[model samples]
Target: MTNEELKKAALDYHEFPRPGKLGIEITKGFSTPEELSLAYTPGVAEPVLAIQANPEDAYRYTAKGNLVAVISNGTAVLGLGDCGALAGKPVMEGKAVLFKKFADIDVFDIEVDAKEPKDFIDTVARIAPTFGGINLEDIAAPSCFEIEDALIERLDIPVFHDDQHGTAIVLCAGLINALELVGKKIEDVRIVCLGAGAAGIASMRLAVDLGARRENMLLVDRKGVIHRDRDDFSKLNKEKLEFASAASAERRSLAGALAGADVFIGVSGPGLMKPEWLMLMAENPLIFALSNPVPEILPEAAWSVRKDLIMATGRSDYPNQVNNVLCFPFIFRGALDVRARTINSAMKVAAVKAIAELAKQPVPQEVLAAYRKNSLSFGPDYIIPKPIDPRLRDIVAPAVARAAVDSGAARLPYPAHYPV
Candidate 1:
């Protein structure tokens, strides 16, 4: 479709359907007067009194266990960048749709107008009791780190920043499969990351937790490689400072850092990676040019430069799409099911492993039909499970819940429905 046509279709999709992507639906019937009394006045009071007496009864009496609040400040709406909270409503609604459709989790998309991190954090914490889990979306870096940290510490519920850890989980999953294809170990590989924002920092940190060495990774922001000798080292945030590399005169630029690197993961903007730069990397390099709509380098362009390269992107047209949808819904499903205190590293790692393992299994007929492909297998071309794969809910959710229970982050035992 033409760009104009695509734009029109998207606008029409949201506008024609009641001017938004989401709507409220009453799960229980209340058509008759008797049903109404039982649904609201008398029956509702019983649950309210029960919850008042025992705070934990809210989960049993209300919809809180199945509900998620997808909150955002609109400061970082995808690649749009700081469009403000009101303008980010559509994306938040789309997230709600994903939650409901993928994992049967209900969501309320909240667009908070608070510009200050503390205010946003406070607002979410104050209203935490109404929902089972909170999924933070599209908040900017540095502040996002602080907001998520404070909220996680303050709230007993599972609080997660999907832009950071969700992207990290899926990225790490694909990377795990990609490394296997290329015969490279995460600890031994020389990694060059081209974005030092939320996704970049989080993905790199999670990679470290999964056995990648901190010293072996090079993190580059817009200014250049985040090296120790940089005069602005003090200006770096705590998260960014953890990955700062020792100053090397030869490794000041991205091109310099890419030299002999085994992997290149780009969360930066378009056209930042040149085709010729692919040659500077080690043989059989893995390139994840994950900038959306348009990647740092196009897949075809990268593949033409190096046939030995294993590439993935944030776009669906390409193979090995590192989509966050693969993480958040299932993660929340598992968290809510197990009543996890927080979506911790162990749960995230379980998600990573589950997604990675799913890709290695034979592609089911249903999945192939959805993609309209006759064949797909575990190879460089197919390193991650498709978002539409039906098995994701069952596979990822249980793994995450088990991890939460094992890690002591969960408040309840695993649900019988999700048996071991």
Candidate 2:
């Protein structure tokens, strides 16, 4: 498509509508007085009494089983930072529509105008009863962590921030395949991240939680490496101290961290990693230049430095795209299916493994013939399964649901219809 076409499409997406993508539709005819009584007046009171006697009956009597609240403060909408709550409505609406389209989960998009963490948490907590799960989206990092932690501690329903954990889980899946392709083990390798934002911090957390050595990670931010000597560590920054370890004292610049690093993950802005930086990495390095729209280092440049490098990016036009869409839909589907109380490290690890295994599975003859392509085996270019793959929901959701149950965080037992 031409640039003009792209611009027109963007305008049409917002201009052609009543400024929203979803609306409530009644299931029953409400033209008659009897229908109105059953829908809102007398019949609704029956379920209210049942819930008053047994709180769990709310799930049975109401829409709680399928309702998910997509809450946003609009502070961090995609690559656009701090767009405010009202401006964030379109993305929230889009997300709500996807929840319905993908997993049959009903969604209510709420744009909270409050900016303070306390206000946001308290507001969402007060209305927690209206949803089976709360999806916190587009809230700025650092603060997003606090809001999620507060709500999860106070509310019974599951609270998930799709930005941090969802992105981390999918990146881990790609890293799993990329490591295997390059004959590297995560435990023995050095990993360097170029951003200390939400996605970078969460990726580091998941890496260590899933078995990467603490001493092997070096986190870089705007003021260079986030080390112990930097006396400006925030509360959330201090929370990631365990991942810094001895490397905190050793490494200084991005170049210093990449000297012998086996993996390079860029969550920061564009054009950060140059050929010199890529060349400094260890032999057969795995690179995830995940900066959206434009990557830190383009795949061709990384490959130019080392032919053995396994490269991935956030753009769908690129090979081995590390998109979070691969994670959130399936992860939430699994969590919602079993009524998970919270998404924990065990569930995240299970999701990572499930996604890795999907791409690792040998392609069937029919699948190959359909694509008219070969060499689609589990390798550098095919490490993580793409979003359009049919097997994703079937494979990842059941594993996550089982993990949630095993971890003692699931509110509902495994459903009978969960596909193996």
Per lDDT, the best of the predicted structures is 1
Model 2 alpha-carbon drift over 4 Å, by segment: 28-34, 231-236, 248-250, 362-375
lDDT against true structure, model 1: 0.94
- Please give the lDDT score for candidate 2: 0.85
Model 1 Cα lDDT, one tens digit per residue, 190-256: 8999999899999999999899998889999999999888989998899889899995988879999
Residue lDDT tens for model 2, 1-420: 999999999878877666568988776779999989988988889989999999999888888877899999999998899999999999998888877776667899999999999999999999999998998999987888888889989988888888888889999999877888778888999999988878888899999887898778888888777676666655435555655544444567788889999999999999999887877878989898999889999988877778978889999877788877777777788998898888889999999999999998876666566556665788878788776666778888899999999999898898789864
* All models, RMSD in angstroms: 1.0, 2.4
The models' CA-based lDDT, in order, is: 0.94, 0.85
* Candidate 1 clashing pairs, residues 3+ apart or interchain: none
Worst 10 residues of 2 by lDDT: 241-250
Query: Where does model 1 exceed 4 Å of error?
Result: none
